[model samples]
Target: MPVLPQVLALLFVVTWGVGAALLTSVSQLSPSGYDFIIIGGGTAGSVLANRLSENPQTKVLVIEAGIRLVSHLKSIPVPDMTCNSSEDIQDVKIPFLATSLPSTSVDWNFTTTDQTGLNNRSIKLARGFVLGGSSSINFMTWNRCSNDYWDSLATASNDSIWTWPAVEYYYLRTSTLVPPSDGHNTTGQIIPEVHGQDGPVQVSLPGHATELDQRVVDSAFILGGRFTYNEDFNAGKSIGLGYVQNAIGNGTRSSAATGYLLPIVDRCNVDVIISTRVTKISGSLSASEIDTVEIAQSANGTPTKIKAKKEVLLSAGVMGTPQLLSLSGIGPKGVLSDLGIDVIVDAPAVGANLVDHPLVANYFTVNSNNTWDPILRNSTLFADVLEDWEIKRQGLFVDTPGNTQGYFKLPTYPGGVDPSTGPLSANTEVIFANGFAPFGPMSFPDSGSYMSVLAAVVSPTSRGTVIINSTDPFAAPVIDLGILSTEFDIVAMIQVIKDIQTIVATSPWEGYVTGIYGDLANATTDDELTEFIRNNAVTVNHAVGTAKIGEVVDSHLNVIGVSGLRVIDASILHTIPECHPQAIVYTVAERMAALIKHQYGI
Candidate 1:
């Protein structure tokens, strides 16, 4: 059993387990009118709930589709496994273990419509429907994008509030850095003093490192690259190779629920409802201003209406927020008409600016003497690591496999401009993952990819739109990710693939391992590389910018043309950032909560 459950079980045993259940039941039943109604109690909603309810007089209600937070096998911190394990990925569809709850039960199992690029296959999108949202299921990489990415948004939106310095304060306030222990070498660093020491989230380096990781780092340096050690990647600059700080602490995933929600669950002013889905957000027009939101609850296989006194906040993430907006007659005119819902706010931009990073994976077979082979072959090592995590909160299970990630501009993207300057080359990001595996356990190769790395092009200018197909709340949306429609995206990926090839060819592995898939190592032509990428690219699963900020909503995160409604999740990102988005979502939620408090004087 995990440490948390053991602690809870010990406490439960002391109180006979009856008091624990009774307290939980009592907290669920005790409810009153809230000043704010937050939909989707995940990453952003949890922060909003905790911060807004800080005022003793203010009431906050957070509605989630999953149950209360619990520590199980899936949620336990295991450093050896990536967040995208067979168990985690397969859990989205199965319903056997407490960890393997059905995706339809707690996750909005959404899929994109067929893409014209990449053989026209619809991709499965798994957005968490649980209380902690995607943060609960995401790889706990605590990386923030470059400052220029946010400054560009501020310039594009004509709003200075989105500037880097303005948002940096929030990022600093939310994170607490774990001080480096004895014998840890953290040199040539720019550590910031403003980082919180008593914050809810715990950010730290991995406790263990495999020798394969060291070889990959050395190889990068040998290939004419510079490596810098960073104590906090959230300090507004992420452009080097280093151990990635994660959102895990003391052998448990520090989800927003664990960091923010669990501490405030017993508060009188906070109400969290699980297994409740918000079907629609209805409003009336009074002298050109919207008034009152009519909320429908999914009860007993039917929809029931409820009213909110103040405002409705949608943190249902990139996919679900737009779906809810379209269902409530607040999207494109054509889309709303097709769904048979009358258009109230003809926000043509709603669900229009969809952006995501597409990753091209490269694999290498390592020598038997390589460090990674032992972990792959030894089941006893794996079990021992798990046991160590359970007992001592130390082992391979607590560390991210993607220990050293590089955020650098490709030589072709000098001065932040793609060599092929077109629609698809805007604000690109090249994420280099070391010692990682793209496929899961069943597909684990014998001599697996030694230092596998994926180069993800983030903040792509390629924009797609997600549309509603039916009036049914449970029906999946038509997500058309118009990937690689522009020539610039193809050029960028070709350059990235070439770059990875150069690293692999020049690395120490040249003597030990064969090339990528045998006989394909020395292909130098751009056409060959482009074709190889087209046949092998997969999504990094970092989808964002669906219901984009400033286009579909106002600066305060409110949906334009509709009062008493706002979206406070990844859907509000005006553009995709150059890194993983979990930390930003958490910051956005914290800021949103403050905005709400200031607006209502709560």
Candidate 2:
């Protein structure tokens, strides 16, 4: 059989609940207090659980808000997948369905507040409610971001460990680069020596070759200078066109659950509780540091106060971390006072400094049928690819359709300030995928094949907030994505769109590219472009800065006013890392784990 598939990037089938456990009742919990309690057993929590529990004497407990999707052997076939919403494991495992997982049971489907920058249009904010958090359902990009961003993080925290060399060491040490499945030569695709050969998480290049992959590489070569090809985007220099690397290997997703939790969760000292909500944090409210958490199976269910003998780590992610803090009376006085909850601390920064990447996609009708339109339009081809993946763990089902990631350091706009830490950090990012853009409510054209150019302002200046609307733990937080709120963010996003448009229109794509589609075509003048942008601006789910370091949490990631409580997630980022955040999030978790162990001398 041949190796490469005609279709673009694919997906892979995985054995759910391989080593991870399911929801356990509060009665099943240990009576004796645990040494540590990690809230939200998602991405960061999973890692902390694994690392913290390594000491045999230190018992660790992970309270997760969502269910761990599990299935026994001889389960229903992938083709026989009857459940679309409730028991949809494919929504999490299949990379082709990456965006489709949102609005499902596994997702905390949040809608942001109306933004004036986007002409008062509110957008969807999807957060993972299941195990491994966003890592379980994201596009699986292992973007390490820029060295400059890490140095700035160290400067912001006044800690030398976050410096480029220090952070870069962990960046390479904690995860390994897996070889592509197709046996393709990776000589120019990646720098093998720069990556960690033996690590927990496995990252890999495109498993199969496609027609669009070469065109993207050729277009980068054709359009010299800024659009030059980058052999390794993960080597601290993230700017330029490069092969997209995902946290996947052996035709399976490499998430926190797969890489961190599954390996050490069954230890005698580790206790994982799923389908449990962390309601309120007690004891830590006062100067006395006897930190304990209240957990429940449901809103009406009985609550149990689980004592943390040593410390409590909050890994509730960007929205959940600050929202949880605010709910527990550890927030701004006005907010806590308004709710009649006793103010534990006057931390206005708990839900402040919210940042997100403003994303916009440009669609085009390509002249070639070599694209993956058939996979979207034809049922026969889809079935064949699905069968190929299920039977042999190969073909179009091994990855998402987007195969190329291009970053650019655009020139500063007129009267606009650059929020990026350094020149190495990308101001703009463009992703190339076959088939029509899967953004907005647009439908596929009845005739020609399509391609999407997703451009995101990686270094956005706009800031938003995350505040609890009600005291009820079930109530969704008021999230203002703050996308396109600043002129600089808008300017940067526009430049990315223009730059990608220029790339496609280059001499290499002269005949293969048909023409631009929809609003982008009509947007000619700067004012028209601005109007077009305001009407269509959205975020790419790369949120950070809420409950940021230096404000809400100290340099050590401990809560500013609270004791025995620390936030070790994306919420504690100094600023957005100017890229897809999973790599940075995992790296930070690893470092914080070591810090916690050292702090306790465990």
Candidate 3:
């Protein structure tokens, strides 16, 4: 239901010239073509390309499956999200337009297999098929998880390198805090010391002001106990409501491509090619080596073999990583054998342990006309707001869905058997939107302005799979998110829903909130609430732990049986973090890049 993108795209076309985006690929590669070949030129791959090519002696090649938008996109901090080749001009750059990107041309358009827990329904999963991967398409909430959540990785992997301090060093080095585009003073909005001063990605608080901003913040003071105000959740203590921070600056989206890849794409030792899919990764598994990659343009296109002298980095995200490995004969023995694939490593964990947060959203009528529904319904007001963003770099367009957010621990974790790692770990998450939140299948109300409240089970114990159904690389993988499969997750969600009900009952929202809309209103008992949850919940797309550490990959992220090959990206997270996994992925890539450099004495 996002407007202004299709309208404003023409304005940008007149402002900046338009043409077909660059589409170039390597038809032939020599034995010593490059020192490293990175598959999927995405979030982690862009970071690897930037860091590895820093040394003049090293050579790097990035293979991206999506088309590049512009030749010199890095020169501008916020480039047009869509071009002649893509749809929704504001989908990537404009923060408020995050909801518009999911089913667009840049999205992967993946649908999960029918889940037994979700009332036998399949949910659509949106991952970025564009240059920057999911980082380009995700709702840009930026925050590192708790200390024990990180230390738990060290315990699981049994490696000191995964410790909190070591990860924190790279975490602080991945992004820098920046002033909001609207020039609003951030006095107590965030803790400045907790963020980095100089880094590739730019992070900032919300740029534009919202009507529900003060009320959302004041709920902590008004409610008194569980709704305490948190100065900053990124400071190793994420427990209460706080101002939302995002990966944005100057009213522009700062993704891995705009921050790392595009800036250094013209380097002498760095090369990039697009619209090319890495079909199969074949090499000697017994010798702990993987050096060759087969790539093709289409399902019927013949694949060409490309050799790598040093290593082959698998930065192909959660689903794609497991799909590639299984196609290359490194997965469960029975699954591969049934598909006529010769089993090599017998890694049963390649596509297992998938974890993602299951979220539920509700809308309520508010007393104000400032919400986006009215503007979206009116062309004049929508254009006026768009003009404000174009002229002053400040407006509703600069704000994301979360104007203020809350993170909390469950009052009574199921049976006192908590899945969270420590005190800082969060069991519930809430996103307070000033306007109608974009999730699930629901149209805006006929007449009233509304506020959308979203609640999610962050500390979910349910797991799922992402496995290859065939040997064809062009085929989509079979993904099952296994949401609400456990009693722990269901119980936590039931309590969280009640907490949201209590928070809205405060004095601040007396006239504002009318009541809950949809099927959520009819639920009163535990049985009814569970039925509504199973019929309504959808994923927030914080998926991690497919090719997890200590199982499919070692502590260093290398495929256990394959040497000179590493699986970088969200797939390596063994246990999902309570916060959004985007920040953690960046921190992991930064840390891993440093180790990869030291190993080669760079």
Better model by TM-score: candidate 1 vs candidate 3 = 3
- Using lDDT as the measure, the top candidate is 3
Compared with the true structure, what per-residue lDDT tens digits does model 2 show for residues 1-602? 01112333344333234342344788888888799999987888988998888899998999888767432112322221111223344346655556556666677877898889889888887778877888887778988788899999998898888887887666775688887767678888888877878778898998867667888888888876888899888887888898998888876677887788777756878888888988888784564363889888888988789889888899988988888898888888898888887787889998998998887778888888667666655555765776676677688767766888898887656475557888788889989887775564344555578888888888888898998868888777899877787778777877888898788877777787889887889998878888888887677888988888888888889888778889999999989988899989988988888888998898
As for candidate 3, its clashing pairs are: 288-563
Which ten residues in a row are the worst by lDDT in model 2? 74-83
List model 3 lDDT by residue over 455-566, tens digit each: 8999899999998878889999999888899999999899889888888898878888988877888999999999998988888888899999999999998898877789
lDDT of 3: 0.81
RMSD of candidate 3 to true structure, Å:
3.9
Worst 10-residue lDDT window, candidate 3: 13-22
Worst 10 residues of 1 by lDDT: 7-16
Q: Which is the winner by TM-score between candidate 1 and candidate 2?
A: 2
RMSD of each: 5.7, 4.2, 3.9
lDDT of 1: 0.62
Off by over 4 Å in 2: 1-22, 70-89, 284-290
Cα lDDT tens digits for candidate 1, 410-443: 5544345653222212233333333335421113
